[model samples]
Target: MISPVIPEDSRFESDPDEVLGDNHGLPAGWEVVPPDPADRFTVARLTHLLRAHERQGRGWAGSGVDDVLVEVSEHGLRTRENVVVRDPEGEIRAWGSVHDRSVGRMLFVHIVERGLDDDVAARCSDVLVEWAVGQAQAVGAARGLETQQIDTGAFQDDERQHAWLAGAGFERVRTWWQMTRPVTPEEAALAESPDHWEKDGVVFRLVRRSGSGLPDEDDLREVHEVLEGAFVDHFNSSEETFEEFLHRLREDPGHRWDHWWLAELTDGDAPQPVGALIGTVSESSSGPDGSYVSYLGVLEAARGRGVAKGLLATIISDAATRGRDRVGLEVDADSPTGAAGLYTSMGWTTKYVTESWHRDVRVSPA
Candidate 1:
């Protein structure tokens, strides 16, 4: 089915009177506008709105509006145009978007705006939710959509935003603890090279993408397989296809091949990678003032050997060499693997706690 088109003149206004006039107590007249790939300003506005609400009392250090724009416009995942609720004067009071549909059945939506005031925000939220449900229904009717999920998470410190998500019928499903370690000259001096670390005859190696060093097809496939096996049972875990994983990473502005590390077993006649950590350093204006670890994982068979620690040390050392002031990563608070303890032992401390909320969708006969 063709997606609904939102007109240009109605971009970002959600005056209460106009909303009331459209349908009295019920939400109506909301429009979803697809952003032109070249429209940087609209994207900037959406990021600004999200940051304003999401970054409260948290370190906003590594975030950039440009980074978000690049992800939305250049990333391989498909993005619907901005959904906006406007007033008669064409002012946007609320806006959001959905991205990365899978099997044309599951779609994820994130709300970027709600009215600034409590009552108005409530009205705006109701309208936005209605529109979202409608959109999901349309997709399901046309393409056999089965489930729709909306992510309404913000930095850990944003109590108001968290409350709003709960009020909107979403249940907290997970928590990603953002942790950081300050980089000091003394710490650097104390930092030992991970080169001397080995586990069960396995040696660690840092991989850098040269103009000529992109991983061969075999290595790429191995990396994908390793990550899938590593986190298959972790919290909120779900299988992500190789293309989906690659698309998500490529969409990020901070992604770099040099940031990845592999642990290879050298005891045999031929060397083979047994564990890997995929991470990217992101710069933001909030938090510890430098590079953030987007993700890190090790294969199950490779655990208990110093592979995980070696990989982390490699990233930390890399950060120091690059003159980064600090390094950060997120860990599931309830990780079954004791990963959080390992991070704490490495000198990282919890900066804040962010929670996830979920609502299972049930279709009702109309």
Candidate 2:
């Protein structure tokens, strides 16, 4: 690894235990540097570097760079939290970030140039994992959480990245299917049959809006509550604060209050939220193109009541009414709830598959 300099303003320095390369495995004139805060330079650099790899049919179709940058600007992300590894010619070769999702939980994102040789990519990935584990450990310590899981993923077909993650001691825990359904205004406008997409004791509709046409905060809070309760038994789920949940969604430029929806179970004397679905506008290289299902959940007590199906129907119909080209969602392949099968029966097809790998990190008191 080349000797590299850390700018004075770096947010978090590499911890000694992490044994992070001083220069982050930079080779020759290469450098690992924090993102530039004042401009789109960081996001643009990341997008460019990864876009080349994706063209080779391995990487994910991430939320477009535009919407991602919106998260950095409106959410809690800071430029220094993610770094770019650039070659001498000023072209980025890799990018990495650690999102501290919650106490004892972290999400690691690492992407390297798909064109790189196995040895080169391995070196880059190792250095980044060192830093990511260090970052997660620090956050865990601060939160009084000594043990945490830092996770990363790769396309199932990308054996090279899999080898790298396996080398880092992460075990493959699960897989996911990223699915999408094509929609036309005409198809979406199809008349709904009462028995279709609905169960006898469930009522589903779009989230309510107040007089000013803004979604009522009460309804928004209800969505969060339902999601938290519904995902309790889901694979690798943890509670997210209401504030974080709300602001995180708002960070997406495609987030519109109108796209939030709800499902209520009415079997009891009173009706209460048993399911919820939140969607965001989707864009293509050309421009605005479709809608994406960011979150959908049905409480365990309400599962068989068709709350999930009803919520999905509302989204599909709404996306059609809005002239969206398609609807997309992600499901865990190993979910006990069989969420992937549900999406499949609803006409969504798997567009791609990814593997999830996770490493447990132990932190001592700082």
Candidate 3:
């Protein structure tokens, strides 16, 4: 039987006694250990590695310090496990993280130092992926699942990453278009239509928040239900509990209550939620901040009623009002719902492409 990685509750404090996964199959001079959330130097090194990885893979770095910190932070560790590799001289060279995103699904991050000898880099990748397989089995057993899917991503043009993932038994499953649209100050008028948009008997508006700045619980649930229903037949749809949904979204560094919106059909006696859109702030170190559409879902019944368009318009107008320079989103390149066509028609262009790689690990019966 495999033991799952125990979660740490202490925040911003070193846990020298924490038990980490074994360093199997690594090079002779390298060691793997759990990352200390309290260590600024370690965090800095991980951030540097992430930036370098992005630049090498995509020709530009988009992640900020906070973005990298959120993954290893105390709050994030509740459902995630991470390890950093150190060279013979104690310099960090690679970082690996695994998140129990949902039942039967594990998210993997494999990052190794750029410009290393090809053989050494390949060895590091093998070690990280081997550790991830153990983690997938452990988490699957803990969740009472017979099998778990390990999902990881790589940039479209990143042949090195593709090769590493392929060597680890992961197959390219899907492609995503990372699209961006420039926002102008004048676009703020997009929201002048009304506080609530009504078309074809459907109403769209932002989720209601209380005076204390917390979103209404009932409305939040409605949004969650709508999204869960909307994606029921979509690719890789997983059943995530409401509590898990709220917790995971809050763990994001850019989560904002006002960035959530819901669409409802009022033709009936009472309004019923049919769509939801969740946006986040994308902080830029070199330019103005942007808005990211983290999620956009419209139920099949509300497909042709323009609910998605209205929700997107709301976010674009909100970004303009907040003086954000652009809006960014990722769309499935092969979506049957024609989502990519809608985005392209709305002025979004593919800035880059990303691919999803997946491997299924079978758990032993307990």
**Please, what is the TM-score per model?**
0.78, 0.86, 0.93
Q: What is the C-alpha lDDT of each candidate?
A: 0.60, 0.72, 0.84
* Model 2 CA deviation exceeding 4 Å by range: 1-25, 57-63, 67-75, 78-80, 189-199
Relative to the true structure, candidate 2 has a C-alpha RMSD (angstroms) of 6.4
Q: Which regions of candidate 1 fall more than 4 Å away from where they truly are?
A: 1-32, 57-62, 74-81, 101-115, 134-145, 185-200, 208-213, 284-289, 363-366
Q: Is candidate 1 or candidate 3 better by TM-score?
A: 3
Instruction: Write model 1 residue lDDT over 1-366, tens digit each, in one string.
Output: 112222223211223333233453423554434444466666666566656555553655335676557535634324332455554554555665544343333333454453366766666666665555555444444334455454445566666556766777877777888898876544443325433345458776655344566755455556767777887787656666676566556566778766666677787799777777776766655443366677677777767877777777767766776677788888899777899999999999998877766654554333
Top candidate when judged by lDDT against the true structure: 3
C-alpha displacement of 234 in model 1, angstroms?
1.0
Which 10 successive residues of model 2 have the least lDDT summed? 1-10
- In candidate 2, position 32 carries an lDDT of 72
lDDT of each residue in 191-250, candidate 2, tens digit only? 262212445867776677777776777788899999999887778888787765775577
Model 3 CA lDDT for position 365: 76
